[model samples]
Target: MTSQRAVERGASVLIDAGSLTRCRHRLYLDTAYSALLRQEPENPGVRQRREAARAQREDIRSRLSETLDGWTEIEAPDARTASELTMAACRRRVPWIWNAVLPIERTTGRRGRSEILMLDPVDGGYIPIIVVNHKVTDPGRGARTSRLTEWAPAVDETRKVRSQLRDQLRLAHLYRMLDFEGIASPNAHGGAIGYRAECILVHDLTTVFDEYDARFLDRLSVARGESFTVPSQVSECRSCPWWTDCRPQLVANRDVSLVASGMRADALREQGVSTIDELADFSGPEPDNWPFGSFTDAVAAATAWRAGVPLLRRTDEVTVHRADVEVDVDMESYQEHGAYMWGTLLTEKGGPPAQYRGFVTWDPLPTVDEGRSFAEFWAWLMGKRADAAARGKTFAAYCYSRAAEDKWLLDSARRFGDISGVPTEAEIREFIDSEQWVDIYQAVSDQFICPNGKGLKKIAPVAGFEWRDAEAGGEASMGWYREAVGYDAEPDTTQRERLLVYNEDDVRATKVLREWMSDRAEIEIPTLESLRSAV
Candidate 1:
């Protein structure tokens, strides 16, 4: 059900709700391809999202069953046949309904299923509630909320709202379907249960539906072959099945999105810089506030990409943050459950030779054991730092990107601070703010323009670094994590070893990439000074 494509047109009255919130090209391709080719199976990313949503919904239903009564769950022969069962459950005046499918709207032809349908006693109708895999609320106030088992009319000032665009639009899609059938609550509101499962996030859909209607119509037009759309690089492309169909086309046209994306790519196209060659051959003064790096850097990125260069220097001099002792760290996690491992490669400048250590827990995540593993890792890391400090050596820990490491560090402290050896949240903040931590990705981004992207996998090969495994990526590792921890079956020691090896390579890649940037980058990569005359 997390599929962006509407598979088996017989099961859908129109495009899926996701089309209103995702890339238009994905919707167009999904609609056009159903008739021309069989739909590709959902990728691991989509599968994980779907599974997480399912698990959350089931947990919500289980809690609701325990706390409330008069709940009916829709069960039918198939998805296409579930509409009647859902409608029957609704007519019974149940306070809660699970897995309810609303019939297609006659006017807009939208069909949807809700994880939960909450009855409004005043109107004798139901409000749609969706279950999602991420956090729905933040720590603050002024967000209207409801208890898990009941919806109150007044705002719950104790809770705050975090707006998730896709989840909101999905609620709008279901509400519209119910409203068209005259089964929607007069309240004109819906709710969602997020990963935290703490409370129902109430959304006033009056404004949201306005946006959804326009978006849904645009997607519907694409579906009915009334509009044209083209594929572009987007956040969703990393997991999109249609990338196979879109990538070749982009390559053939030398699309600008290959090097720049989002508003940058759109703005470039508007400026008549649609192709890589046009961007590379640009001869004018640079635009104000060019993203990531300078305008010359973007041109260099385009030129290098077009000419098949891996890395191009954007500055005459290059230096990566290094110290007398360094440790490269990488984290591996599964679908927001928890960070299961922290892999580290310790390289002492003159002391003992480099060593790799992994602090890992095979226990399936969302477990307290996670806290123990995290505390252990933190203790070991601090011990190494202290050892360096005692020896009067400047210490630094590196990661390709600080975002993931920062998130887990803060989260580990926040979630497990009470556990022995775990630091306080303030300590994590102190370390993150200090010069003792470095992001090699930032150093590379500051000094170079990588047309292919600055991902560790993309840049490591240029530094002559290679991973032993053929399938080495975050997505692939998520699959390995499932098998390694026995989330659905018996644990595989082989997969666990594979994960350790992959994690080790990731940290080692950062070590090598940093060294290459310090020692050889300026000499080997095309310099900005050289590309200046050419552009």
Candidate 2:
């Protein structure tokens, strides 16, 4: 492994690249866990994601190296020491140096390695360019870019910029190290090559420098024992190595994060309310810094959490939209590659028993075959709507959330308009906007308050729904997807069946949860009014 890669594995006390981008508490825990010799929990899901990202990074680095014909790539061993890198920069014979290490900044305790350095023509310094594994831009015309040839100026204007904070922060980290060497470009801009690999994406770090400095100083304080930070739940906790260690502690204290996380939890902590019990007992004027508009609802949600009740009705009764002819839809996609499967469950009164239909393709994604599969799924779903209209039956299609399904719906239709049975973008927008399309998640958000979480997995179980597969989850399914499609190994027929079952169960879960919301929530779930009375 490269010296930089070793640091990413997390056993060091010093702040390196990517540290500031994570949760501040995780940064502190990296030092604490390493000092106490606590092992990071072994997670197959995390390993799969890391390995895939690393593979993509290596592929990009190798392909990019081929384009820089005469640029020297410092050997991994030679790249370890700052003297070697500094000497190469001083000589400045070549315009670019690949895999150049930056000298450690002792004052801030920062050390890092870069993918490429473009020597400044006007001065002896160099500008840092980073290569990342994900796409940095969308198809449009705004962001400045350049040809992949040599240390080119970012003059290309073919693509629009995708503002990724982690990407920007990473560039900031590298640039800070360069600044310490007194060899950084006078300009605050940095270059990055995203998954496109077509050109360099330029970012102006002038806006982010303040954020970087503050975060670095904060992390340095944690590392040096100058400041204390406890684990606070944040979205980053999902994939964090310290999750197994911190989640237990959070739960043990019934930390307010168990209900309201991130800034909401932090805001609660600031008001001297740290546990569920404390938040539930608040009967006075709301704190000036309260994050939510409904302090009553917040307290009620906390009360349900303290009572170990998974769900609480917002009112005396919960009502869900139901149609004479209804279709429950769930999509399964492997990352951003493509939506490979669209599973549907059709249910109606006095009709043939509900049937489960899945339109899927095992073909490796990014392949044109994805268009065919998507076209078929779209064609079939629209056919269901057309059938409902012909029968003069009320119709609605339900999905947990529209963010993922709506995205791929338009994406699939746009990409495969030439194919038969593909809907137009305007058609998709009309359908999505109409009452015929219902997002059950929004219904749940309006009708119920979930304490543990509002995720499909968390809420569905409250309705007494269980998945057929023991490991039925998006992250687990992503790992199964690789095997089902022969991504790196031979395709497994069993994994394909597992994917199908998982997708079917997801749609069924939505149906079950919706029925429960409409029929059982009033009697089964605690009322917000009752929770308030108990408080």
Candidate 3:
């Protein structure tokens, strides 16, 4: 419910910052549905994760409360009035409000009419706070600025609002706004360092408010009339609640967007390219106007779309150093905490097909257990490398993506390693840079085009490898981890086993991709002729 309605009904309203920033059409449609129809209950797994996140936030808040003082939770007279008071107080440099609800009036011509801003206690004042449940050094500066503007008032009512705040005996100076990232870092003096927002950008807030005023009303009308158009972008479609109804229409019509990713679909439409068939059949030389940068690239993309395969650019080349033994590695991490498990699958030429091993931490609390697990896994890996060298056989670790694995390893070493047990920074650097570490994800993109997408689950099945559990995914694994760690209650062994199996399958999928690439000198480039003949 909007803050205004909530206040009128003597209830509390919770605002979701991300949802409030979405497309106007999406917001209106979702809001209308929520008001007019009962929403299907969220998936049980989704619900569990959400609950876990809430519990985590409360835990952090509790810890902070003990360290800080002079924070009070106050009920606003109404959502709109509260927002007006917030802006007035901000303009007058008033103290921060914890769980403050600022209302954006519909009459103000804004997309989201209400926002919630949290506060972190400061010496003799307060700083506006945005709490995120992940670890990241930079959480897009623009998004944070937008969020700040959302809390600010569009119209001038300084005198009236200030008078109200004075009458209500609630007025304090707000020092600044900051982002409190949820991820804990050993390097951080506290669990997080507050990132201050760029206040200069707040001036642009008025322009956005004016633009929304001009357009949002008409968009809302369209939504209420049930005439909202399905978005062409895949990311939008995938996240949309209306995907089930919209996807079939797009597929049936052979919408160009299904074949193209991102904003390129609109550019293609401007060039009179609107369908898969048209894109595939176009035989003209690369047009100088081609948005994809080259005629050849455009044709290659079209050809892949036509054949339902990933497009591999001609310049793309993939190479893997020949090794007598290979290990496919995939780490299952909970970004909310840290990497919890390392799954490795070993293979040898003319030897065993797969030897799966996992180094895991059973602790649910966010702590050094992940680092201990990583150290154990690394020692085991080094032992295997030494054995391979003694046998005069090259040994290599193959992973889908090096960034996550590399980052986790480096972070773990820095946080948990001792001088004698764990690999030093130099050794870790050499391992990552050397041919001993192979990133098959970079290899595939370098050698082949995958129109369907680059994710292992999407690409591995085409290479003839399948997960034992059909429902296994990153999200499911995270939920399993939560259950295993006893986030809600006692740890479940079944959940832990399921997590291991899922992670094992992920490494196995990488191995399948590796083997497929090894056997093919010229990567398979699906063509219309080949596709038609097979059919």
Candidate 4:
């Protein structure tokens, strides 16, 4: 057995004089382009250390081959394949170690040979050649010039080493383009392929350039040729990294705000509105030709514009925030459990003492009940409005001083509308607006005075109204009457009467609190922004 080693030291080679005579077997080790070649080993420890290093390197090569799929592993001839793999691994490793040691200069970096290797099934057998290259096939325009400049020197060096290994191993016949996992075709731009019929082939040079040794492998090439374009679709310039430089016309005149609004601008292409100006002008509101849906949509869009929030679909959970004064107005019906005409009172402030104004629905025909039915009750409430007008008091139904209870009041109003035979959403909106109905809880939340979390009791306290405290004492117990009705065998009949009484109390309480809020400064009142500022 014979052992021969020629150390390569950057384009220079050194061989031990004793190596030529030590054994019967002739071994020729060459490092023709390295400048750090040494002539001789000082001791037996050097060979032992080298063998250990070789084993470790082989282990790394095996692990890497298993780590990523699609790459072929190769071995070198005339040396133990494992030893060659290890040597290749060492070659790649040394550069990185040098890179860390002299990070600023990056001079000592060399492509390690893990990417190309030599293999020997037996521990001390002659290594056979196995050319393995990453089977990445990128089906796009091949490497371009601008891309090539960015390649790291380490990568260039690796290529050179791999090329040298291929030449030495006589593996040129195996030079068919193998699919590389990540090597994108520079010409194809972004196209991908795992295999290429193209004759391009990369031979394994892991004994020289390990994959990890070259961090710039992916960026080693550039694509210069124009990529193939689809007939109608054109190229995906908009998504390209060089889009700004390559397709200025397509990206220059963008309306940032409109795009930021999250409206699907792509959908508006059919309307001949590719740009924001075209969209704004073409979809401008037509006063006379207003369709309710279109009008609402436009309004919603405009609202989003002003609010600086995207126009989102309407949902029960998502509330549209407005800066307008929030008035928590509740309405009450004249009847207890029965459906009929009603009166509404609104209160902005919350407290035991509340003030409010009542508006009665006009119901000419009255129903027949033992007591005043809801219709008849409305007639009486209308009389109160007349009396207030006569006395120089505001006759409006909406109150801004206390929390209003208006569940029944709204139902009654709808009944009046039905009876009046006026069927229109606009009419309903107008009627509601005329009442100036403000949701108390919403108002408080908008005002930023209350926690804005839920619950009427929580909101009422902010306006100096304590509905809980007011109803807590035995002086007035709305719950007991409600319970009594429930306990009674005939709830509809008995509950109706008690419900009316409870409704009356609620109305009165709301009214009292309203008066206190309008006149007193002791209670805290918050502006709309304050209420919603928790976020």
In order of listing, the candidates' clash counts read 0, 0, 13, 87
> Can you give the lDDT of residue 174 in candidate 1?
87
Candidate 1 per-residue lDDT over residues 1-535, each given as its tens digit: 3334433342344766977877878877776676654647779867876776778777877888788878778888887679988887777778888888887664565868888898986777999988888988876788888878788745666667777888889988888888887888988899988887888888989878788989888888777656778879887888988888888999998899888876577777777788889998899766554555556667878888876778878678898788998999999888778899999999987778789999999999988888898988888888989998998998999988899889889988888877888899998999989999999989988887888888999999999999999999988898889889897899999999999999999998998898998898888888655765565
**By TM-score, who's the top model here?**
1
Lowest summed lDDT across 10 adjacent residues in model 1 is found at 1-10
Off by over 4 Å in 2: 1-12, 35-41, 78-90, 120-124, 139-142, 150-160, 284-296
**Which segments of candidate 1 are over 4 A away from where they belong?**
1-13, 35-41, 122-124, 153-160, 283-297
Which runs of model 3 end up more than 4 angstroms from their true locations?
1-25, 35-37, 43-56, 75-94, 109-127, 136-228, 282-299, 308-319, 418-420, 520-535
Clashes by residue pair, model 1? none
Best candidate, lDDT: 1
lDDT of 3 by residue, 334-408 (tens): 754678899999898889668999999998746767667778889888888899999999899989878899887
lDDT of 2 by residue, 193-229 (tens): 8764778888889889898888888877776555778
> Which stretches of model 4 miss by more than 4 angstroms?
1-372, 390-392, 399-431, 435-442, 452-454, 468-505, 512-535
Model 3 worst lDDT window (10 residues): 167-176
lDDT of 1 at 57: 75
The C-alpha RMSD in Å for every predicted model, in order, reads 4.1, 4.5, 10.2, 30.8
lDDT of each: 0.83, 0.80, 0.57, 0.31
Give the clash total for candidate 2: 0
- Residue 310 of model 4 has an lDDT of 26
Lowest lDDT sum, 10 consecutive residues, model 2, at 5-14
Q: Using lDDT, rank the candidates from best to worst.
A: 1, 2, 3, 4
